[model samples]
Target: MSGNARPSLTMKSRCLLTHRAMYGAEQLGSLPCVLHTIDMLIRDDVIWLFWFDHQGVIQSFGVKFVQHTPMFLLVLMALQRFNTANWGLPNGLPHGAPADEFVKLEELTAEHSTSDSQSSSISVNWSARTCRSLHFVGRCTQIFDALVRRRDAAVAKLSFPDVSRVSEAVIVQRAREVQTAKFDLQRHLPVLHFVADVRPQMSAIREFLNITTDACVARLTIWEKLTPIVHLRGADFRRCWFELIHAHHLLWNHGIRHLDPSAANMMVRYVGGASRCPQ
Candidate 1:
């Protein structure tokens, strides 16, 4: 396929094509079976089994595949949403945000972009930049918090392995530790309190805190990686398709079978006229 050519297939057609490219033509009939297996893995919490097996008993290609599949699906969903938006389709972004809120977000992004080109001088308008940065960070935290809550609820329903053979005291302690590690609104209260109490003398400390918080937030929002696809040219998209093909071959070389391979599970990063799989 030529790099500059638009993908001729509709989404459904592209899905099938990508699957065929990943798993080979003979394995197409097994796609449904693969998907069912992945569903069971997610529902049963088998992804965690590998971690608990200290002797590497469950550390196999299949176990690694199961553990990674959830993240793969997340990336795929993000890509599909980006592509939908790129095609001028309804993006299905969260609908409850007021129009004014979106306008504010756009305004912030515009101002941020404008600031990037200005000279790095002490005269720079740091106060406006700081406020914009804080607003963006807060919005990101809210989104991340929502995602974490939903995940925690789903995880609560999942069936973990029976540890009844272990002491009840140990299990209870472990459970408490896990709960404490989980992110909740209460965990961020101190940081929020500090930001709200900003003092002139604490400018350096506040900047440090902002940088730390931004780094943490960025780590939690891998879905943002998909946004680049919205700006990709037709040639870059085609290159991405080829990169997915290469990824399939690479997996095969390592004797790893991506049974549920599909367009949604494959992600391509485009940079400097080249394309590569994020995985």
Candidate 2:
């Protein structure tokens, strides 16, 4: 090609141009321009088309942007995964306390299962009180079982011929089940108490708990010092504490009550941090 006519751009040059186009669109603060650039990048599968040349040498063009995009996308994916993994059915009752204060726990578990699941679904019957009462050993064992079940189910689902064609509702239902199982495994399990237990195969648990507790305590101390600066009232402070550190419904079912506001109570380190009185 004549120099005056301009030489053909190489694959690497084209890839760099694509990246520059995307970067420029990102900087322009225009949604349409950004979308158009993305469309152009995907058009004719241009990036992947040039990924492997005829000589079978893998093209490493746009390596920086290509590598960084996946990592950034992975972070976004992780956040989405965490949000979905932590989801639970909304607690309609006030303060997550059961409507009947003195109801039989076993009967309530049965009733809750019936109320929560339709006839087609498999329901795990568990009372919040029972969950909170489980020993550390039992909690860990249950968590392991739940995780195993989730993994097996996922494997089975993907092994099916029609896995890709599964309905959105079915996938969502599975995710909800996995989330519920995780919640059950961790509910009412005290990290500190579990760590303090001397049992075989608990060295790792102890180490993890020590670090977690120290970090938690340090953060709590900072919050305690800052509380007065914000002038948070007793009820507001209690609510904030519960929201921050305690799972909804679990603590309420365990008979743990917020103490009246006092300097001594403020210093005491409860499972959900310092106690505050209602204003």
Candidate 3:
């Protein structure tokens, strides 16, 4: 594949959704099985996950994918190789994706259809045996329909100008400045978190973020979610800075230098309680 041409798992029908109450708490921890399921949903541009009860009714569980830095894969690999011995899992890897976890990937299927403006009215068709299982446990039909409705709504509300000629640096710079805290308000929408129709200067760059939008969304708002007056000691900041430098160095080694390193780009979501490190 080209540098920008990513080879993604197009269709992952087998996705196991284990019942939390049925299985013991210990068996319920890691969820590697969800990766395949998440991959399928993301590939189809379905942004959220909706879980239902045994009665085939939708319940409260809903999940949205978060995007990470461009070098997230490299950072994940390094963290796994260096810190997995001390930490439970690498930072960027899915919460439940581990061999020792013994999580089983479940299969899901649903009925869906593709429509064109010039074609006849929307014709319904049952998805293949593979795609039907997702709709079974998750109410795939409802979820898929929700996606279409949201997409159309977005189209109707679209007012931004085309941005195909802008550089990644420019777009990144603009997105970082978006500091609004409202959940549904308009602001500088980070490319990592939300998808926009702006035209990209580089096709590969567009494809890069577009393809991985689901995974990197969290990193965009993590810092914002922390306490406004987070009380980090001088030493904690130093340690985080050190890790940031290390992450940047790794990227440099890969020939991808991030020209700008603003507060927005450096992520600080540690797993444990706040620590006091020696200055």
- Candidate number of the best TM-score: 3
Q: lDDT (CA) for every model shown? A: 0.26, 0.25, 0.27
**Higher-ranked by lDDT: 1 or 2:** 1
Instruction: Quote the lDDT for 148 in model 3.
Output: 25
Q: Encode model 1's per-residue lDDT on 1-279: one tens digit a residue.
A: 123332234566446544433333122112111000111122232221111110111111222334457665764575567442232111122222223221111101111112222111101111111111111112212111111112211000001112222322232223333322232312111111000100111123225435321111111111212223334468876765565555545545545445655665554444465654443
What digit string (tens of lDDT, one per residue) describes model 3 on residues 136-245?
A: 22212110110121222111011111233343334444444434343221221222212222111212322543533211110101001121113545777766556555
lDDT of 3: 0.27
lDDT of 1: 0.26
Instruction: Give the better candidate number (1 or 2) by TM-score.
Output: 1
The TM-score, computed over Cα atoms with residue i paired to residue i, of candidate 1 is: 0.21
Task: Mark the 10 consecutive residues where model 3 has the least summed lDDT.
Answer: 214-223
Better of 1 and 3 by TM-score: 3
Q: Give Cα distance to truth, residue 179, candidate 3, Å.
A: 32
lDDT per residue for candidate 2 within 1-279, as digits (tens), equals 122332344687577656754454333222100001111133221232121100111222222324347744664475466421122111211122233222211111111122322212221212222211111111111110011111211000000011133332332233333333334413222111001111111123225435331110000000111122134456765654453344334333444333343332232213355543211
